[model samples]
Target: MNVALVTGGPGAATVGPCTAAPSPDLHYRLPSAFNDASSKNGRAMPIDLDEVPSRGSQCASAGKRRSWIPGAAFLAVLFGSIALAQSPPGTPPPASAPADLRQSKGVLLADRPDDTLLLAVEAFDDGSIGLVVSSLAPRCRVPEDVFDLPVQVDRAGFQLKHVIRQQQPQPDGACAESIATVYQAEHYWPLKTATAVTLHLPWGAVPLNEAGLAYLKSITPARPPPALPDDAATYSGLLDQLTELLAAGRNQEARAAAEKVLPYFVQRPPDEGGRFFGILGTARRRTSDLSLAAASFEVGIRLLEIAGDTHSLGVVSDNLATVRRLQKRLPEAEAASDRAIAAFESLDTPGGKASLGGAYNNRSLILWDQGSPELALVYNEKALALLKVAYRDDPQALRPFLEDNKFLRKAIKTP
Candidate 1:
């Protein structure tokens, strides 16, 4: 499975938040997920692709149910006619075709085989047109040359219609085999007055088939996107700088950066709440502000628990335990670590198991300091085994824990 977002700074000379390793899961907030100030946290409020506007839809048609056509044979027929400039010698002629067909007017034509092609058209208020065309072949991609599609719309009563060419065709990577492409173009015609239009592709003047035309007309127009919150960009920039500063062991700078974004924590969704506060807690811990670190982590934990974000909850709780340990709050620290372990166990992934290892190690340290070396040894050993798997990708990543385990082993041997 792909690892989720893991954001934390490195630790100091001893075991702490940074040394307590969690797998890397960077959940960057892309613009598409949250266009406006309020919609920034889509993890808790994921946008429905189908409900998005036609021009701005981030929909993935991959893995959906589709009535497919025989791709190879159909393309062969369509392109074959183009290559020879005529129908095959023995092939029957196409049935009588319609005239003055246009996309906006909802002109319908006869259906082709299921595996042929699918097209969706969207017209905007500013005379802009968007087209989504997909090749239905199971393993075939749309030929690169076909992307240079040029078409002319034949409006009734006008001697000539507007001609448009695809300046760009963005490929949709979601589909495994078929090529789903989107084209955005503009026309000079008055969209409302156009009674009929015909698309003149390289192969021929293809009328909008019934299914294609219906699908195009059914699309909802996109709304003008909302503006972002004034502080959104600044807050994000600060968090990024904080992560970098913490990574570089510049605790003071990291703490200051965290403070800049801390006020906005309440406005974030659970996932982002856990992320920002967790980062803040790290900065506070590195600077030895145990109380502030614990406070930040508590808020983060509350948000994660409310959102059922167990994965982040587990990592942040582990960090909180470390801060509590530094403050000599043994009971509180142990309790927090226990919660972390529980959260990790529930995750059941490699990253989760690795996080649990860090929690176990922290608990072992607390137990050792409390004069229970024998009991601490058991937890330490368990931590070592789990951490080995967690850092399997880079054994050096486990160096700190490996050294700690070795020290614990030698200490337990003493009288």
Candidate 2:
């Protein structure tokens, strides 16, 4: 049995007007733990590639309740810059792997310079292929058309699949200097299918080994491209429905809906998988299923890393701390919260402060549980101060913090 000291408040979504307004999916408003939902309006926020990712959270009193972190669903064209002239279906005959691709160390393409190019091939499940020419230096520039020579891919000594020269910036920020030139290869390779192939770059020929084949297979295949609704409102309406379901305590339903809509997000710039996993993690945590909840958040972290969404990554990290705390892993929870605070504090964006506040509040709980009431009070006060900035638009959003302040104020005075 659960002691419902304070009821949870609602989550917001940004859906189209097509659907009926959703019920108040109020997040729990207590002092026990903090809720870090990514959106403020109780709906999903738009995923802006230009903006760093940030999420929203609500807090509740001293009791077990769901941590609601709302994330906005975004739909955008994946690899819009590259025009993939769809490849023909059918796996090419397999041949022995080549030695060049098998080199433990990536062969450098450029001469003695600050930057070097490590050539690699990335093939996705959707049959979209790209030759990634990654620049080794952190701040280096690669040529706009890096692969001008006649590139070749042969399966069992057969060549001549149509290749394009659509050079584009690497989506992942970790490799800020990397560039990709997409290719439409024949047939999609499943995860772990080792095939003999060669990349005929102008600098030299880079052959792939069976291990290289497996490496390409291991790369997180981009989600299959989604056929975005012709009407933005329809998409919005769909997002709204998802939010309402999650807010209404329909955890399983929300997870199912997120999975169903996932494939369509493939090829998009933002890591939609990260956002969806975050949503699923929240729903699972609410149900007190800690193992599954942690798994979901872990996956979200990976996807965000792949997407290079620093802001969203911070938001997810903050939310993970709350989940770890609920699982009674105080040390892990504290570490996660600290990491989240660091990430958020690095951002100058509007959403960063609120995220930082939520992390501080979460860390406060861990400290309080560890008998550090004084430190807890300090963090609690910090949360209140920062959250005030985050929820300025909606005074109602700050209700839980106000309650926390009242409680912490008294608790600090007790000693």
Candidate 3:
């Protein structure tokens, strides 16, 4: 249901190819049978990371390399710059709770001239809870690392410490922007009778009041369909076949199938045609046909715009920017990125915001290629901020963007 977008690697930076993960708000429903098959095959089946081409690489060399790593290990490597102290996984809570509860709160726990801490908490339906603490320090101090360590836990609640490390202040008395570092930790304790949580900082204990325990209780979770509807079976089957072909690394076969089906969808409806064109474009791009990919994305963009599908329009436009960048057409790439950013900006939804972040990331690369590192850094920071907001619940998904920001900053600061 999720689509991967290639938004990384401009002209000749050392950074490798980067991809944006699917936002939760942007998903298409496929038949349950097709979903089952995709799951069994160990593929999301739409656009896997391995299918994206690396920038500055020859077209013939596209899709020739694959790097697969475990999710936990990948996260560890991604956040290695930030300190993380993980507690041992706790045992499951007993099954005698009266009712499920979910709540979240963000409170400013400490405010001082040197340091500030904002604490956020979330309690899940299963009696488990998570805490995120953000520490802000003056950039001149060079706050190097931040982490959280669990101190104690029981039915009465839990205790933890927020640790911050910084270097000596710069002698010039010059100051830059404030640096914010985040630390997260989760606990499996049953909180049925818990009253409050305490954070043990270097200064004192900051007790966080849990006044709104029922804030998230009224929210409903989505349930999956029991079976694939008969009316969508045929179309779903065809789409599944194409996705499976791509999943199996048969790019040529997938491209052929997409070409065979593109016309029929194009005649049916604007939305359908737009989606299929995106598929066709992805297929062609995977096969190293940059011109055909750009052409397909153009058609898709027009169709999506006609259908008033701003989300898909943004996606297609972003993909076109990638194609143009790969072709070394900086102006065209920047134009496409602008269109994509505008499309996403018009939408106020979370998916739109995340896609907008992706568009900015693409534009940053193009600017970097055009020898505008300062402007590139600006756009990159914007992308990071938007992406962090959208992916707050799934911080691991921000790995690529985080890496890009790190490398871009290093590049900007290097002589």
Per lDDT, the best of the predicted structures is 3
lDDT of 2 by residue, 1-415 (tens): 0000111112322222112211233232211111222233344322221110111100011011111111110000112223322212222211211121123133345422343444455454656565444433333242222112222234212121212222222223212233334433322232224355565443346565555555566654343222233444444444455556777867556544543343333322335546655665565455444544555566566567676777777777776777666656788778877777887888887767776777777777778778897888889789888888888888987887777667767877853
Instruction: Give per-residue CA lDDT, model 1, range 1-415, as digits (tens).
Output: 1112232222433332223211122232333323234423332322221111221111121112222222233223322322222333332211211111112132234323322334434454543344434332223343222222322232211111111111111132112112222222211222222334454333345566545444554554333222334455654654565677677876666565445334334334455656677776776666654554666676667667776778788888877777766666788878888888898888877777887787788778778767888888788789889988888888887887777777777886732
Best by TM-score: 3
Q: Better model by lDDT, 2 or 3?
A: 3
Clashing pairs in 1: 4-25, 5-25, 5-26, 6-25, 69-114, 69-115, 101-197, 102-197
Report the lDDT of model 3 for residue 112: 62
* Cα shift from native, residue 363, model 1 (Å): 1.3
lDDT of each: 0.48, 0.46, 0.51
Position 187, candidate 1: lDDT: 18
Which runs in model 2 stand beyond 4 Å of their true positions? 1-189, 192-241, 247-249, 259-270, 392-395
Reference-based TM-score, model 3: 0.45
lDDT of 3 by residue, 1-415 (tens): 3223444453422211222212223233434443454322354323211111122222222222212111233222222212222222222321311110011134445456554444444433443233344444453332223322322222222222223332222223322211112221111222222344444443345554444223222222222112222344466466666667667776666765665333234223456556666776777677666665676677677667777888888888998998888877789898989899999999999888999998888888888879998898899889989999988888788877887787888987842
Ranking by TM-score: 3, 1, 2
> Residue 64 deviation, candidate 1, in Å?
69
> What is residue 412's positional error in candidate 1, in angstroms?
2.6
Residue 126, candidate 1: how far off, in angstroms? Answer: 50
How does candidate 1 score on lDDT?
A: 0.48
